[model samples]
Structures are given as structure tokens and as C-alpha cells.
Target: MKHAVTVRNVEARPTAVVAATTTWREFPALWKPMLDEVWACLRAADIHRGCRNVMLYLDDTPRVEVGVELTQPCPLTGNVVSSSLPAGRVAMTVHYGSYAELGAAHDAVIAWCAKENLSRTGVRWEVYGPHDDDPAKVWTEICYQLS
Candidate 1:
């Protein structure tokens, strides 16, 4: 299938995230609880009042690292700790569907990057869109930096 790709420069912003490491097969079950816990924290702090979405950063190498954080402090979690990332150029794509389809989207992005002679650096991130709470309508923007 053809994939949609966009290129843009993004700035590093302070983000609160729950970090973990897991294998590809174990990710679903592990992620749910982590997000739920983070969500609860956000709700308790009333932070989701203005938040847009959460970011899921994926790192796969010798060990896998994953982090979920809010794009905005809406209300998904409370008492979030913010951290800054470096500014860089990135390739982006929006995937519209269930989380199950995310792997394919990721592959598409990687393929596109390969075809264009671009290399990825840092952990890949999936930016959850506004409707992150809903499975069917969840919009996630997947991004990988070019190196």
C-alpha cells in the first residue's frame, strides 16, 4: 500500500512521560496500564483540561524503550514532569485507524525513508491526536528524525 509522508522541522518541547522497555509482542498489554496510570495521574491533577494528545516514543535496539507523554496538559495525567528534546528535521505521517495498524504505518514510514536515502536517529515517536481516547477515530502522527 502507498503511504503518505511529510517532512518538517520540529522543536523540542518539555514533556511528561512514563518510560518503559518491552518486546514488540508484549507492548500492547504493557502500554495499556502505563497509559492508564498516567491518565489517572493527569485526571487527579486536572491537567487534561487543555491537553491535545499523548506521545508514545519507541526505541528498538539492544533494549526497547517506550515513553508515553502528553502533548498538552489537558487532563490525561497530573503532576507531569517535563523534559526537552533537541530540535531536528523529521519525516511525519498521520495514521487513521486502530492501534493494531500502527506497525504497518511505522513500516511505511521506514520504507519511505529508505527509498529517499534517509536514516532514522533517536527513538521513533507516535503522537496521539485529539481523539486518542477513542480507538476507531484515534489519529496518530508517527515521526522519525533524519540523520
Candidate 2:
């Protein structure tokens, strides 16, 4: 499916996350269990968890933080620690379908940025929407930081 890419400013948000370094292919197996760890930590801490999940990618490495947005800044709890999504301008697009095709959304953003001569900052993230029983109803927002 064709994705419409847009540029916008986003604020830093506090999150409870589990950091990991894994290959792109290996990440699919890690995200769910990682998020589960974060969720358990949040529940034990009596913190409210947001409805969406996020996976923040670092600029310099394969490391990623898979977790949920926090309602407020929180202290470290177990391996689930305090981290914030950097505030900045980003090229964003929402992939409206199965998670299997989410990479196409990222590719769309990459192509859009290149066509517009916009340089990416090497950092990016995916905000996963609530899951659905039907694969066609899933949506994930891909955001790449802009330089």
C-alpha cells in the first residue's frame, strides 16, 4: 500500500523500556517479550501505561528500546528504565495493514526524504497501534528524525 509521508515536530515522551541490540530480523522475536517485561515493571510500580507501544532505534547502533509510553517521567524499575524519545522534527507515516508489511512504510519514508532532499538523523521509531484480530486493521506509525 502507498503511504503518505509528512513532516512534523514531536515532543520527547517518557517511557518504560527494555533496551536490546539485535539484528533487524532478530528484533521481531524480541519485541514482544521485551515489551512484556516493561509492562510487568510498570504494573509493579503502579504506573499507568499508555495504549500504544514504541520501539525507538538509536542512531549509532542496532540497539532499540521496546516499551510503552509513560504518563510521566519515572525512575528506573528493574530493567525497565526511564528514557525519553528525543524531541525533534520527524518524517512520519502510518502503515495501515499487517505488521508484516510495516517495512514498506519505512521504505516510503526513506524515499520521500530522499526525493525532498531531507537528511535523516539516523534515529527512528515505530509507534504500534492497538492490535486487531484482523491483520488488515493493524497500523504502525513510522517516524524518522530529520536533520
Pick the lDDT winner.
2
- The whole-model lDDT of each prediction reads 0.64, 0.86
RMSD of each: 3.7, 1.9
Clashing pairs in 2: none
Model 2 agreement with the true structure over 1-147: per-residue lDDT tens digits: 899999999999877789988888888799889988888877676765454789999954678998988876555577787787889999999999988888799999999999999999899998888878998888898999999
Q: Which lDDT value does model 1 have at 136?
A: 66
Model 1 regions more than 4 Å off: 61-81, 84-86, 132-136
In the range 1-147, model 1's lDDT, one tens digit per residue, is 345987889887555555565676777677666566666676677655444345545456313322344455544334334544435898889888787888888888988898998888855676676665678677778888778
Candidate 2 Cα outliers beyond 4 Å, as residue runs: 46-49, 72-76
Q: Which 10 consecutive positions of candidate 2 have the poorest summed lDDT?
A: 42-51
